[model samples]
Target chain A: MTEALASAATEDILREAAAWRDAGRGVALATVVTTWGSSPRPVGSQLAVDQGGRMIGSVSGGCIEGAVVKEAQDVIADGRPRLLDFGVTNEQAWEVGLACGGKVQVYVERVE
Target chain B: MKRDLLDSLMQAQRRGTTCAMLRDLKTGGQGLYINGEFTGDFASGPNLKPLVLKAISEDVSGRLPEPYQDIFVQVFNPPVRLIVVGAVHIAQALAPMAAMAGYGVTVIDPRRAFATDQRFPGVTLLNEWPDDGLEALKPDRRTAVVTLTHDPKLDDAALSVALKSQCFYIGCLGSRKTHQARLNRLTRMGFGEADLARIHGPVGLPIGALTPAEIAVSTLAQITQVRRAKPAAPQSAAA
Candidate 1:
């Protein structure tokens, strides 16, 4: 694990906003639209990652955040909104930090 | 629309006030309405605002205790506060933690040298005596006061205000012996034993902490426990 403990998910979201502002890029907000079983983050949990590789917010238990961040940067670059879904099967869920067979669907859109 | 209302609610929370956010959860995507204003993308009828406001006022005043009251009202505007009656190392640690936990932290100490914005950045530092500062604070159910001075004059003065007010958590940093002494003195000063019981002495949880930072973490854990017990509402405020 990294030496730094994970920050409050809220901080992650705002940092993304600042990054967008700093880099003169539009922002895309991603939110957890659905969830099932024991999940660290609840529905409506949001992460707004910008094109400048800076992020603020979290959607998974530190599992899907990196993936979400990547998609967010792409959304910023393309200026097209998309709904990215993850955590369907058991194996898929395990890859994204969802243990205990919990699946969460995240909706990512570029809403500047 | 949801974002706008949430931002307004968070603004009120940052100022240590309560606000109501109404969300129509029946639909697939919720519509957030704040203070009777149709702030969402989809507009409902005009009368919805009055109805939601009535519901919110009643819920905040405790006239309604329905199961979803927490979701409907409290989470929309969570209480964020910091009551520090002393300027010490423990207060140094506690102030920042409280801020990190989304509290609008305020520090009170008569010693101007001890309490300064430089010592505790991003916190409101009051260079007034505890009693004077607390009187201005008007601690309510959302406020959390912690005393680290171990000086009776400062602790007692603030405790009097905190116990009478609606503050939920009252903690004084002291050992077992000091706590007993505090209780005895407060009892003599006309405070009931029950009131004394409300104050958490030895301050934090029994985490065997020694340093100021560690102790701050333990105190934060205890404070979070109280916060979780009273899940305010589900509205997010912008920092």
Candidate 2:
């Protein structure tokens, strides 16, 4: 069931990214390429962001989505992909509402 | 090129066709595979082809192999369908729950009053006969057919059609005695014991369910159990 929801969400992100690019709005996609310990979302999860900060989907279930969206803006602007690592400390985990410590690797790329 | 791939993918999804999209992160290349046939051109070399096929067969989405670490495979299958061949109380309870579980539900009954929009809102209501309705719906492997009407006229017709199809689940609501009678009737109609074995008579898991909603839960639970069970070896006709 989780896989089904994640698959559907990824499809939605791809479709929205395509739509945004077609409308001449620069688009970038952030994908969770790897995760260690108790991550909310699994690998292959995606979040799509447009130039104006409009977003669809989630890579870390709101824990690091804000940061990913921020980096996605840069990727869209420069058309250069970058990998981001988020290793949350216990205090940071509490602040971000994650249940425990974990690390997530997200790859952000301009959707061409 | 991306637009064309997106268009084809959207069309395949709308048509409920099984497909997979493979995207290479390193090169930004994309390939679309629909029903085992490749459509768009992408660098899915021989090394990664089997993995893609395995992903499609399992209906799962994940990253590719070590050499193709950057590539991701996303699989899309048709939505599961549930066809309830009666507008009984159990149908009323089951339809909504099935819908909540992401099934496209259709409630069929020739009796107009029982099968009403007021009773089953947001469900596809069919006012035709059981055989005709099942014929039109064309229950596939992703479909589950349940007969709640105890009447031989209705349940038998629906069972005849459902048993012939590749539907993953076929459950008929009845007591043990009633099911025995049903088995005898079907046997008289030329159905063998193997085909009869597929019908989950006295349907639903034995959870001491006494209410309509509880029975619906049990039925859905049993259906989910069968769906998630590992596939067994194919039975030969002579077996």
Candidate 3:
């Protein structure tokens, strides 16, 4: 299931990337490298964060979207990529609304 | 990607197969992209378009696995389907317009003369009674059934079946008075008030659509909106 969802997610990112490239708009890709605790989606989930921080997919439910968006925009601005993680416990998860306790590690990268 | 699966999907689509395409949206390689009837790798360069076109057009055979298959299906899958139960002029215009809007259109009418290929050129023409046809068609969550016949016999069967099943959208062509009368009939037949409410009588988005073509467009637009609108956020955003 992870592989299938990732595959489609990747396709969507690539397709969007192509569209952005064709339109001459900068884009970046973010992947969920790892996850912990109760989460809606699993690891390998991705969110294609564009230069404008407009997302094309999701990495975690809404738990880490804001953080991911910030990271994506930073990646686009820096023209470099970085990996980030979030929600290791109730305190950190409180901001993202993860039930019980859960966490996610995301890898944000810019692709040509 | 599995060649056989792609073939099955395309073949089903060409033959108007009624099934949902479940796309996996979280995986792919280097630069693979998928649009309806097209799947190509960014690394492959210019050759990708031709490859995808050829693959969709020809009787290709393969089984798609995990992410790639899901993406292929999502990009190519027919989301909401419009099954028009009448062969009116409105259907003629609506069928093509709906197709253009990415809907898998099926026009069903017992009148062979009315529901001809000429009338709905590119549509999946089914010359059968609405009820019988719908029974065989089996309306699912992704299916939307519309009754333009305005005739009780034809429209009622569809409404009955649609009300019983999980069909997402069910609309009938009628005026306020006609709709009330239809609702009364449905009530008499033991349809609950809640069930009767599902019918979108006076179909179409109150866009002041007058002509048959205009009405068709209005109906299609409303269906599209209903299909794409995201579900409201519940208490939890876990998944």
User: Top TM-score: which candidate number?
Assistant: 1
Model 1 Cα lDDT, one tens digit per residue, B1-239: 13444455445544534344333222223334444454553364334455446544433311113433222221233435778888888889988787776676788999888887788877788887888889898897767898888899988999988888878799989999999999998999899978988899899889999999999999888887875554678787876
Misplaced by over 4 Å in model 3 are A1-112, B1-79, B231-239
- Candidate 1 residue spans exceeding 4 A from truth: A1-12, A15-23, A33-36, A42-44, A70-91, A94-97, A100-105, B1-32, B45-79, B229-239
Query: Which 10-residue span in candidate 3 chain B carries the lowest summed lDDT?
Result: B58-67
Question: What level of docking quality does candidate 2 show?
Answer: incorrect
lDDT measured at residue B49 in model 2 versus the true structure, 0 to 100: 64
The model with the greatest DockQ is: 2
Q: Which candidate is the best by lDDT?
A: 2
lDDT of 1 at A84: 59
User: For candidate 3, lDDT tens digit of each residue in A1-112?
Assistant: 1222313234455466556755766677676655566666654455766677667878777767887787777777776657565765535555664554666666666655
lDDT of 2 at A24: 96
- lDDT by residue for model 3 over B57-105, one digit each (tens)? 3212122342333232222323357789999889898888877665668
Candidates 2 and 3 compared: the better one by DockQ is: 2
Q: Poorest 10 consecutive residues of model 2 chain B by lDDT?
A: B39-48
